[model samples]
Target chain A: MKNKAALIFGYNDYALEIAKNIQDEYSHIYIFSLHSEEDILKNKSDFEIKSFDLSDKWDYISENIDLENSIAFSVLEDIAENIFLTISLRSSFETLNIIALSNNKETADKLLMAGANKVIPLVQTTAEMISEMMEKPIVKEVFHKILFESGELKISQVKINSSNSYLGKTLSEIDWKVKYGVIVLALVLEDMNSEFIYSSKIKNHIISEGDIFIIVGYETDIIEFEKIIGSRINVHWSHWSR
Target chain B: MGFFSRLIVNLAYFINTSDAYQRKKRFFYDILENNRYPYKKYFDIFMMTLIFLSVAILIAEVKSEVDENIEFFNTYVISIIFFIEYILRFWISSSVTELIINRSEHAAMLGRKFSLWRAILKIIKVKLNFVFSIRAIIDLLAVLPFFHELRLLRLFVLFRVFKLFRYTTSFQTFVSVLSTKKFEFLILLMFSSIVISVSSVLIYVMEANNPNSPINTMFEAIYWSIVTISTVGYGDITPYTSEGRVVAMFVITAGIAVLAFTTSIVVSALTEKLDEIREIKTIDDIRKLKSFYLICGYENVAQEVAQKLKDSPIGIIVLDEDSKRIENAKKDGLVALNYDPGNMRSYKKIGIDLSTQVKAVLCLRESDVENVYTTLTIRSINKDVNIISLLMDDGNRKKLNFAGVNEILYPKGLVGIISKELIGRPVAFEVIHALRNDYYGVNIEEILVDNRMIENTMYVSELNNSRYRVILLGIYKKNKNRFFFNPLDSTILESGDYLLVIGNSVFIKEFEKYLHKKIRT
Candidate 1:
């Protein structure tokens, strides 16, 4: 069933973000922006988008008038442009849900007066971020990915079970692949990543409760094995596997 | 029970073990372990074999239990125990420590470890530790003066069950091997169990009616079969008939080989898995510290950079993989952990993630490549962080430069530039030595500013007074990456401009006084 959708007009990257988050839920979405074709083409992310200039609404509507399936919401930073786009989309598609971003209280009141279904003010969000950045530079990176420029390897968590032959032994004696074709990156326990990578051949580095191994494998293998790897592996804590 | 009493006993035992006069003491004293020699392992096994043979001989040699040959029996039994303990000890104790320390052929002959006589001496020597331990007293009772008067004590010799611990290393190795080979060895163990069960049934079927048949039932037969296979060969029981004897012989040889094979494999497996001690990698070995530091990654320049930083009392974190460098660091008592700071976790190990505590992080890893990475990770965490790094290869300068490091130390390129001056004189070397040692390490220190200065004041002298007692070395004009090493003295110290000074507590106090004056006004 195709559900009624909203056209996210212009909240910069957040427009695409909203569309992506609810794209599968809603049947359709349309994003309009001033971003150039070159900028859009340069991005490698896999998001489906179709763009058209707001001033050329007549030609856009005449060519592709699919307003029956969607709504229009302008997230443009400028007040005059957002109001013009909202009024234009409403005049043509009266039943469509209209939303727009506002820079201030007066702008939000203006957007609402122009027949927007709702108006979200963006100044408060920027004001909070401004305060944060001014205070802490260290916390900013913590909120982003830590890139190891030269190191090619990445670490992730995996669990152990009887299907793996190295249940009772340590890392030094296990034949990592001969027994199971998984290169243990590191053991991730509750608090820290352990020093040893227990291969199939290690005899003394015994697998214990809550021991998660960081394993590296081919992407396809990892995907196929995720059902067995990531989920809780129910192992009976006993002397031998039943 | 008392502390001094325990100490006294322990010391006395130590002196006994360490004494010069004691012959066969090393083996008997067993100072290396639980006070027993491993040669006793082979001896016990031999004695068990003899016991098995003696039981067989008693049944085979005498058809009647009531015998007129008590003297012959006594001589034979006494000789067996005597030959096993004394002769074997004497025989085994070759090149023994008692002999070596005494530096005489006679003492060495007695002290030779393998000799049964030497073993006897060792046994007596061990009795010394029993002076305090209850277990030791019981052990002495089982072997000695009590045994002479009481035949029960002689029988207590069978309490030699304690000899089992004597082979702990081998046993531990075997257990480890079994544990590692848990999956593979399980199959063989199952097969061995079947074989043992089958042999017991077969013996019970064949020898049910024969007198003197040790196979009284399936259980006894199975037990005997296991004992024989494991080479325990206790002489308490033996097969009577010729048919049973034939089966026993085959089982004995096969059992010996299988047990030996299992033991050897386990020992080899255990030894292989024994040690996997992880050594700290360079740079990661450095522990976290709060601010103001220098790190010289390579050995060549490390000495100079470390010396200079040491003079300033700043926390210096050095990381190098070379053992020689690590050993040298150990002598210095600086916070260090061996690891590649270029690697992801290693950087975190040195607490790059906690860069707030560290005022500036120096990328002094092995080469320019690592330095570039160190700079990148450090900067990615703290965008405004002060970073100074080395570049051995000129080609790597662009990469390190892009990483936002404050300064790059290019050894070869800088040397080429320095060669331009003092061609004949050693003034360059002296300058290099002093700079490396004490020439006020740069690219560090806080920039204090008067927040209340007039917006248009351009010259530094307007802000200069005893209240701002420090000299204005430089100003970090906001939004610019360039630094003036020694700023023009007349340059403006605006409200936003930072006054750089070589820090001292007194100078900093006076400078803060300027800030107090600004607030008062």
Candidate 2:
């Protein structure tokens, strides 16, 4: 398994913010771009770069690239190019979960068919963002601030070790709601490769040995995963001993 | 043996071949033992044939000593056939019961009661029962063997024509259409009321004094109204008066209008709602939806904001004129709209106020004035609603405050700012264009949060600490009417907090992956 990321197609500071979000985890990620106002040298590093000519369609993903670990996005001015690139990437790497920047419903549809794992059209997403802010501002604010920017919220991956209470514990057993302000996204099990620990796929997710549980919470909330359940591993695959 | 017994046996076997045969066998043995019981359907066939054959033999005996010879040589062959038929029926039932016994035994540990209750209670055991569906109580009537002899009584089957009720798929379809378009149906019903009332009054006034008029009483006028509206003009009740004729014409027209209205509503609703269904089921592999970003209205500004947020992996929920925006969002892999956003109820329908769950609300409505109003409504109920409104005028930016807007943007102004940068700082635009281009040297971006540098005390110190090469800058925060460019080192870091740094464009997005923990180890 490797690391991956997507550049949300935007020509402003917003694009830079999203890109920086994913740089810390991967060794070197790919950027499907040739230019930007916000310089990446200032705040982020360790990324492999590839330029896509919307006019020429020159984006080719390298082979042996675990598509599940690769992210692609377009923030350029051309809506049609963004859609075309997403589709082309999808055809070559069908399972390469695409995160595309769409302009409207039509483009979004094209992206989905092109195998974009996620499509974020500007108007549609903005409307939802506003509606959510209006509906529940505080909790959303805290979550947004923590997960996005301007806060101390960190979501980490911790492997279950021999000593913690979570050694044989199911997700439901932790009672995360009352104990700590944390949400368990997926329990990573070495054997449960068939199970990607989807947030919604909540059945038959047996967390056994050599499995990793991917959880999201504040750095403080991680004490539960570290102290109560399992010893935190470096998450470097080389150190993952059975 | 008896009429009722025959019916009981016929119904039992007709519905349940296995259980019914078992019951019949028990009854058959009882009857042989001289236990008094009524007749069964099979008994009728058996007894009648027995009597007929016996009578034929007796006649033969009388005619030329033929019956005497036959009776002296023959065993009970007819009886033997009847007995064999009975035994086969019992054997078939026993074998069937054996299957259920084995299945239930294996499933015993599951503690589920295994029963083919549906098969046992199945009204129609075969295609022949479909005949029963069209005609009421066919099996019940045919049970009475006497009906076979009484030809006049058999004519009563003409009344069984009512069983068409079961075969009415069209009528059932119509009913479903009516229920689905219940609100539209109610409107049509209102129109029917007008027709009925108007016709009832007109008929009473026109025919009350006429001795020859068939529309004499209120009930008769009501019945005529129903027939006229239904377009079923059964001429038994004719309106002889001019006034009644006028009302009848209006009723006919009104009926036609209401029918058309109902049809239109139903057709339109089906097309509109079904399209929504098709779009919603597109996305399959979504991982988690922390919060839904509900855009208040569908405007240009909302569209731009939605694109920017979604590029960053934040989920978007759209509420606008077209409810289909929600479905489109879902297929795009964001927690899209499940309901409307403006109407508080519709907002709840879309998961707007579902506790502290939604990530953020970016209010990019068409009009800042309208956004202020909408934001006000949202903020009143959910005080924590993170409202980011689109403002056209700088003045509206202040107005949005009273409504509790968390962030405000002007699409034109933002565009103007970007364009100004294009002119004022050419290198800035080049950097952006270069970073956006993958071929150039790695572009720079700043991640607000990352795991490795969580305890990096100062912005500069944090950048230095990261193993991945990057830069650092002062963080930005709006504190008391001004944007704080950078704060002091004493700004102790919380478990979940922000950072200000500079890095490669691709790596910034990579940073969010670290935050989302999307990396594979």
Candidate 3:
């Protein structure tokens, strides 16, 4: 069998960005174009480049490409072609994961109907990224980690059980990094409501059973800290240690 | 016909597995499910007209001046039509029995053989299910005009108007929106009852014996109290004694307080519920969605994101504790929830977990600490969902990341980049700004090579030399994760390559047209 690859259809900036982000996850990355084959060939990119028509039959694709192990990106700028490509690919290959890029919700719905497994709206991500970069505050306290701190630190949360010794203790009272080898970030109440320990609403909130504490530490320290507070929540990001 | 052959036809018809049956099912769906077609719309208009005419005749008959026989005849005509419509709805639709029978894994095990008794049993089961359904119950209640001679039974004719709600999309949406806030309305009602009753008893004790008092008994006092609290002041009752006057004054002030509080609560709840209704029309709509970004706290960052997404085709639901913020978001044409974002009940109320389509949850609260808490709570609820959290405090990044936030958006770091980019490269900044702002008609577009062109190899300069009006800015090779900018003309064409092209609006349209023709051919 040919090596598993990510088939990104579209010769565009968004497709390029997507390829950049997910390249590490696949063995081979193939860029397919529908609009301009000459433009693609002129670009001296290190990876393989190819062109294809939206009307290409499944038999033709299956003969040329390994559909079983390939994931496809249908980021063609034309919403109709994107949807058509998604539908054709989906009908042709039942398990090929198809990700399509949509310009808006209506097209996104159409693409979804066309059988794209995932549709990422381009403008929204750009808006989100630009807003993130332009509007954030730059106080030292807020920028301390990104600016001053660097380490292989991991964050996790532990629920405070009724049996824990630090039930009523405040943040100042606990030498968290020394005693528990973890830094308490915030507290989540039993009602599933959460607040930063230093925030006005929770500055003096006495620790109680069922309150989850967001903490940060090394992998071993987090394990040790989990023993004291209660069972550690296997946070989705806890795999960074692995 | 043999029982087996009849059963096969009946099963094929009822199960609607055949193409003809599927078409019939689509017809039923178009008419019965929603007012989407001209036929259904006209049908709704016809039914509404008949309902109003019947209502008018009933009112005229109640006045004792109209001919009772004519009114009775008209009522019968209306009821008969409604009855027919209801039966037609049942016949064309899939009965509950057919659904269960077809869905069951035991269908094959039972073999192709069918019996008369089994068909009867299926009909009986479906009838029971249909009778119990709210739609059928409404239909039955609305068609009770046969008992028009009974005065008490005639009162049920009012329920026929409610059937009109089913035909009107706006009316159904309004009712469902109210039902969503049923608990709040119920609480307000309960509170109003207590206040009126207790105040009535107190006033009855204070003024029942006063010679000048209009209020005499507990019932009269209760009526007076309700009128006072509601600010209706029908002017039928008055307090005479000094104690009674003081009690009345206190009750009046309390009435204002209650009205203000309850009205505010109901108005806000109704607004939020209506927005929710607009978000999801049917379960199928939610099921069809691949995934949506859930934003908690519609603060500045969240608003910015929502504004940008409004023009895009991404599904987003914004949750905020402030009704005003939610109202603002709705004004901006966004699906926003004005409930506690951290509440699991609220999440379920909006159908968040229906399918794993919740792609990411952005905890955009201004507080880094709160963001962390939100990240943790969301993680606990759905471990697989990606969480992108705003880091207000840099110190909270580790905590947020540890709390299972897949991505941490450092707003502060972004500001730093903007300042550097602005000062270091102003010209490049303007180009970036133009693209971001879509200045002029110039835009950057990404085009993917169609599989039909997989065998063809064309160089970049050749395309630039041709009728292609777009400028090929760059090329990205997928396997190597390489982006070749301002590429050489000798680059070989391959399948699945991405070309970043730039062109004006007209040229882009031309290029797209050219591409469509090329790909289709």
Candidate 4:
């Protein structure tokens, strides 16, 4: 069995936050700080700290961590350095999941082009937007639970297999919420384009094999949903971590 | 005291103390002096029309035989309106009776004998000050046309054109712009006057002896000097002598220098006032909006909110103390003002009826203190205005809440939470982000269940999801102020409850139409 690990670059507030939040999810979490040895020594953190430069070939990362079953985050504050780190990691390990944080839309595009699996634009989340979302009581509660007290509320992507009974059926024909206790947020199609489950484009779309459904529910409910739908978790990670 | 004096004093006290009199005075004050009064615009337009009509009649009277009806309308009707307006302005400018009563009361408090003559003198002094003011003098001259029988006083009727200065804001802004450069103008005036006087004397001295010179008198010389310096050069007053021609050359050169100086001064003054004038125009535009979202700062957060609301029916007005940010917002096609968000005067300047006109106030300043101050200022102006403030620090959340902010948003905390989620469940984070940023053309929107829905006794199951293609996320029951996530199909929707759903933008529009159709059916 392969062990799950998380590789986080940079040692800033966001890096520390990701490390602390996912400490239990990974068997071993490594924080690669780009700072000098003295600076890293002065600022001690809970995660294992290893210094890495932009020019490094990332050979040590491949040797130390199980790349196939691991996740990598390029969250350096500098946009250029972050993009370079994403590129270096992508070159070393083709199957590793790499998530990069970007300050704006331009950097987000550049990071994606730099072979980051996903680019989370910091501009997407703003104070005004949070306030606007908070205006809706239901959205507020859902986000509050998801962020602060995510108790057994697991968000998983499930891929439909060929033998599923619901194949060739449209989304509107099924009352998934009432029958499965799982909320399907979106559908990732064969072309890798995602559509909201309730979107009009997908209302008449046939649920064919290889289509992935991003769902949110309790672990038990998600497992039951996957079993009933004749599908499996989409991610390669063997064990789902809370 | 004499009988007349005692009677006047008693009348002053009565007028000063009467509530009805004060109310009437205030009513007239709003019509005449208050620019913000709802009816003031109509009153100004009416007065402007009358002024234009009278001036037109004056010009027509100069060359043509006027009709009796037209003469009567212009001379009597227009004159009476102007007289009434002048009297109303004089009445509102100061309260002599209030002053008298207060002075006498103060004398009594000091245990000194009240001097009636001294009080009368003080009252006259105050009234005299108003009488001599430029506005009051213009009003007096505008009324002087009533005495058209005195042809000399007829010329004073032209002063009605100057009254346009009071009615139009653009004219007022121009006057204010010039007023700001008073010191520069004074220096220009001094320099030009010296040049004019010296040039006039020199021309007079040189040309008075020549037979062909028009500069025979000091007055004619001064006129020529002014005409030459102003670059008018009528040529009716040409210098005949060589000495006078040489002096004319010097005068023309001085004219160019003076012209350049004057041009530069006015240009700089106008440039300085351009931003203020634009801000005023923006404020005026905001005041005309029936409803608008007032975004306090033109930062990234405000820009994002504004962009999201751009297609909405509600107007958006952005305010920032930074001129560059305001310029950026303006370039983005938003009504932006370079006005301080924390200043109470900025709210008053926009003249928004906050409770009725402002849909919501978003305080998106980077500093928590500024956001808090803005919230307090808005709350002080209108207690019912919806305020949403950004909390830069978690510790300032309570402070912002205490400042009467309806909603407090901590973006850093949100970012931390989102980043954490990205680590644990990256696909779920992407879905949420896509829904928010409209990446996949999907959106989460809220629909209000009004009385129509409640009257129809609608249930969650009644919404034909297949028809509208929207998924019901939850129901926000307004009565309980609680949210039911994935509510049961049997749950009945009530009035004031909000239906939260996720769908494509087009689908949401259709879903809303479907809900409304059910109400109608």
Candidate 5:
């Protein structure tokens, strides 16, 4: 496995939060501050802070990190700057994964068009939706366990290869929940269209090589499911997330 | 106390304290005075129809000899209803027994002799006050036609038109506007009366004795003065003398001034009441709603919630003190009101029947303190209304919880968590977001297992996920008050259980239809 690194562009609360959360997941975390010298000095944090301007080249980034194994977050508070940063990173490093934060729908669309792998719209709509869904006590409990209280539950995607035993079997032929203690949420087809596992159109559809199954379970249970199914955990497509 | 007096006091107390008596009085009060009562509209419609029908019959009788049956229906049925309504109004206007009981209780509390005579006089005073009120007088006159023997009382039937004022809210608002401008109207009346009286005397003195003039008497002169002052200009009684013409000129000018003054007064009063009337209409519309979500502020969170719920079956009403925000919300095609969300009276003013009509309340104010206050106000109004508030600051989370907020949403924290998840498990986070946002028509829905399903003895295995095209995430057993996640295939489904499923929304609807169809078969 290649060593993973994170290059977070923009030094703000959201950047700080992402850095802090993913600190242990990656071997190195770098926060690129776009502000002036005084402002960067004022923003003292545990992560390594480096100053960068919008017009700068990626010489320092390329020298310091492996571009192919790194993830870059374009989370500048300014929407225009964030889009520009995403474009610049994508133009500089073709293989680096780029994620951007947006405040509204228009900016989100723009960020995606500007070469971001994924755009997280930091709008209140998602919050309201979560609040509405939390009205159900069951949902609240499940989400609380998954996002806050318990860290054991993991959602992982596994892609079937040619040698997998379940490659030619239909979804209905397997009782994954009873046999493996994991719930398969959806399946990504060869064309990248995702379908719910229980969808009637895909009920009898045979799983084959390159088919990705999105599943959720405890970490141990997921790994066991992956082992028994003869597949490896991987994200097949960058845009397949949504 | 004397024995007779004690008997009277005991009787009054019994009547005042009896549940049956109080209930009957309350029923009448609800029908007559409580506009919020659901049945009041029906009562109002019935009374309006009766009044119109009786008036129509009265007009028909003047043109031709009406059929005896129709005449009897009009004379007896309509008048009897009016009479009963008047009696009910009078009975509910003030409680005589309560006044008596209260007076005697007060005297006893004061350690003084209870004067029966004074109490009787006080009761009469209160009753007389109601009887002499304009509404009561109108009610009395409307029922006067019941005395068929007195032909003169038939003219009083016209007063029934005034009774319509009590039934319609618009008329009540007009009356309120007029009442609010009482001082202005009084001044206008005084000014016009002085002008008319002085002009009438001047014309009478100047033109009554002129032989060639058409005004031959003081009465004619006074009539001319009134015609000129009203600007009617009948031309039948024009002043022929120059002095009389001069007086008429002054009266006409004063008449225009009085007309302008009256118009200004009424216009200003109506303008002042326009907002209140509009609010009343909005409240009436809200009262008619079967279920609605009350968003306490028209901020971003509220705007998003309202937009998302716009296509839903439930109604949405946004309230904020900032008129600009309300206007923006209105432009977004939502029912918005410029009302202070923190004020307890706003709930009452908006007619939020939380126990019945209000499905939930979202306190999404920008200020944490305001959200807490709104939650407290809503909880104070009704304890069972589901309240969700956005926590503007982390420090206010406990405050919001203590204020009885059902759910507290921290948007920044939620964003932080999502950002973190995106870094660690990007695909999973995106999948959840897509499900929540209903991306590509996929979403989560809850379907209730009703009595039909229970009667059919359905099992979890019977609801095949592949067949239904939906994944059963869990079963919320209402009886157990617990959710059974990933239940076994043989788990028997029961009534009141909510099935939480995830799938394409269209497929979910079809699956629900199939469930219903299966039960029917």
Candidate 6:
């Protein structure tokens, strides 16, 4: 079978971001716009580019691209244009997956009526969320895992017991990464002072009985690590009934 | 077959086929399932009015000089409606269960089909259960006047008012709220009862022999105690003795204490229920959204994003760990939840599921680590959802990359580059500015030169003609890895070439139309 292609129908930050995100999934990516500038053209790579308007009949699109397996992204910056693009694409290619961008609910509904398979609304808070997310390391890790990785890893916190053999020992002596296949993410000492495991302070600081280790690894490995230490409680995705 | 068996089978068949029974069943469901069916508003109004009239008649019947005919109409006519309504309700409840059992194989049990007689018996049992239910008892109470004329029976008419509970959501919510705090209410009731009974007995003992005392008998003493404790002293009965007066004073103080305590409990419970109703409404609103963005965290950046989202029609739900932050977000007119952000239950509570309308999850926690964890938890619950994360530090990029962040926004880095462009290159800055703002007529856009445009390479200059006058700024030749700026009219174009153009919005749309012209045979 031929490779599935992605057709992005606008030139904007959102279109560029979407093209980059789904680049791995599609074999070929084609970005279309009426005009372009240096900012959009910067860092351009393997994807094909086209100058075309979707308002007209898709004669150029139909003859050139494989509509059957390809997904069309209608990421026009203008809501009206985006809806028109979606309607144009959907009417031309009945079975083609058309993803459109809408700014609001009314536009989204209009795009839906125009036969868009999916409507990804560029909510205003997205930029704010992006900036805030970068500051939170765990959130970044979770975001990466969900977006790019298999996400089979779990984060668990285990408290050291006085009876444990490794008590009072430095984290370097544990060889957690090699032996247990777990990555120690952070630690909270007996005094409730916390720091990332990789921080310079935790490198030489001896682990005490009441010390808590926040580790990330496969579920089984985490469980095994917990067995060696004391019992473990998951730091993330724990049971929250309320 | 025996006579009894044949009769039973025939009766079952008649029950199944009777149109009146079916209509009554429909009517019962129409009234009972008011939330689901159409025209329920009218049915509800009629039933509510009937209840109001029934209670009114009951109040009127207590009068000493009421018209005989009107009294007869009240007792007999209204009683008939209540009787019929009771029977219809009983039949509908049983039939609904039977219908469900008949339709669902699991309900009837696997590999065992119900025999006709067994099914009838099962239905009859269910019917009997419905007939004896509290609601049914209330229905029966409303019609008791037709069946029995016991002087005390008239009092049961007051219970007829309880039937109003079924017709209104507020009444149902009140019942639920009361039941939830039933233990507290029960304790209050017990304490009140003990105080009233003991105080009444003591007052009776003290005041019975005093000629100035109005509480002469045990019943009157009980009434006096109740009135005093309720703080509604009718003054028909009073204690003249010093001990009895002290008891009366204690009863009034206790009544106030009990009233305050009970009122506080009920007021708190009702407020909690109201909050629950609001949450339910939010859930319903979330359900109506086609696709929405879930912003996790409410820091400065997240708030900025939420502010921008105000212009979009897309729904947004903000999740944060701090209740105060959630309250603030709510005040800002966003649906916000203060929950364990990494918990799957939290997502589920907000209706985030595998195929929910959650188009994207943006992890915006102030800590990069928390964002990564949130992304992982959200991914675990909804694998295919799009996730955007902010990259705080370059070091955590690899980890976040592996964690599956689709879009990593480094706002600081972007700002740094844009700042450089603004300072060094004025024209480039203006172009970028034009691209960002729609107010300017001239904007930059890119177009791909595909198979259709390959043959038109000879007319590259004509492409810039007045009909669709779009300035061709440059051509990105992927094959040669070179850019051709200010290309001559003779410059040939090929498939997979990118052409950057500058044009007004009108000219650009026109240019796009020109590029998409159908090939004539």
Top-DockQ candidate index: 4
TM-score, per-candidate, Cα-based: 0.29, 0.32, 0.40, 0.88, 0.81, 0.48
Q: Write the per-residue lDDT of candidate 5 for residues A89-168, one digit (tens) a residue.
A: 87887778887888677898888888888777766445445445534445555555555444676677777777777878
> Where is model 1 more than 4 Å wrong at Cα?
A1-242, B1-181, B187-195, B198-209, B242-367, B378-388, B431-521
Give each candidate's interface RMSD in Å. Answer: 26.5, 15.4, 20.8, 3.1, 2.9, 21.4
lDDT of 6 at B82: 77
True contacts kept of 2: 0.05
**Backbone clashes in model 1:** 50
- Which is better, 3 or 4, measured by lDDT? 4
- Model 6 C-alpha lDDT per residue in residues A1-242, reported as the tens digit of each score: 34567788887655666666666656678888867454347636655677776567676667766776677778776878888888777777877767666655678789889987655444322453353343322333332342234556554567787788887687656666557776554466656432233222255678888776755566788788889888764221111100
Instruction: Tell me how each candidate scores on DockQ against the true complex.
Output: 0.01, 0.03, 0.03, 0.39, 0.30, 0.04
lDDT for residue A16 in candidate 5, whole number 0-100: 76
The docking quality of candidate 6, as DockQ, is 0.04
Tens digit of per-residue lDDT, candidate 2, span B1-521? 24653354455445455666668667755443221234443454454455355445544645576654455322245335434533443343233333434444544567755444433334224323433442325433322222424545433333223322223333444455446777777877887887788788789789978998888898999888888887777878888888778877888887777668866887876675664444333212121246555556655655555555665545555665555655465455554544435557755433334346555565655667678877877876688756667776665777888889778755434333332222222222223333233224343233444444444333433333233433222343323321122333444443334444334445555554544443322
Model 6, B1-521: lDDT tens digits are 35764455556557767888877777768876646465776777787787777677777766756687767776787778778878767656756443434633442466554454665566677778887899888888878866537878877666677878877766776788878888889999999999999998999999998888887899998999888888888897878989998998899999998989889999988887887777766776776678777888887567767775665666788888888888889989899877767888886676655356876777877578988888888777766878887776656878777888787776434432332222222222232333333335554456777887665544465564334545454566769866554455666777877776555667777777677673433
Please provide, for model 1 over B1-521, each residue's C-alpha lDDT reduced to its tens digit, 9 standing for 90 to 100.
Answer: 24653354455455547656355454543422321354655655664554444344334534655353642443345445544444333433342343323333344477733333443465455544344454344333323422334534444444444433333445544454457877657866876777677766767766767876757877788888888777888967788887777778877777877787677767766666653112222232333244545353535345434543554445666665555676676567655546555556665654544455565566656477767876776666668767777566667778988988776655433222222111111221222222222233311134445455544344655555323334333455643633333344466565544544433345555565555455322
**Chain A TM-score for each of the predictions:** 0.44, 0.57, 0.56, 0.78, 0.85, 0.52
lDDT of 3 at B435: 41
- In candidate 5, the second chain superimposes onto the true chain B with a TM-score of 0.85
Docking class of 6: incorrect
In candidate 6, which residue ranges exceed 4 Å CA deviation? A1-242, B1-43, B56-133, B143-157, B270-274, B284-293, B313-315, B339-363, B366-521
Task: Tell me the tens digit of each residue's lDDT in model 5 across B1-521.
Answer: 88887888999989988999999999999999998798999999999988888788778877699899987877778888888998898888898888888889999999988888989999889889999999998988898888756877766667887899989988988898789999989888888888878888888888878898888777786787778877778899888889988888898898788778888999999999987787778777887889988888887667777877777788988889999999899899888889898888877767777899888888878689889988888888889988888886677789999999987777656656776676655556556666666776777778889987666647898886557678887788888987676778888899999888888888889988777767524
lDDT: the better of candidates 2 and 6: 6
Q: Is candidate 1 or candidate 3 better by lDDT?
A: 3
- RMSD over all Cα atoms, model 1: 30.7
What tier of docking accuracy does candidate 5 attain?
Answer: acceptable
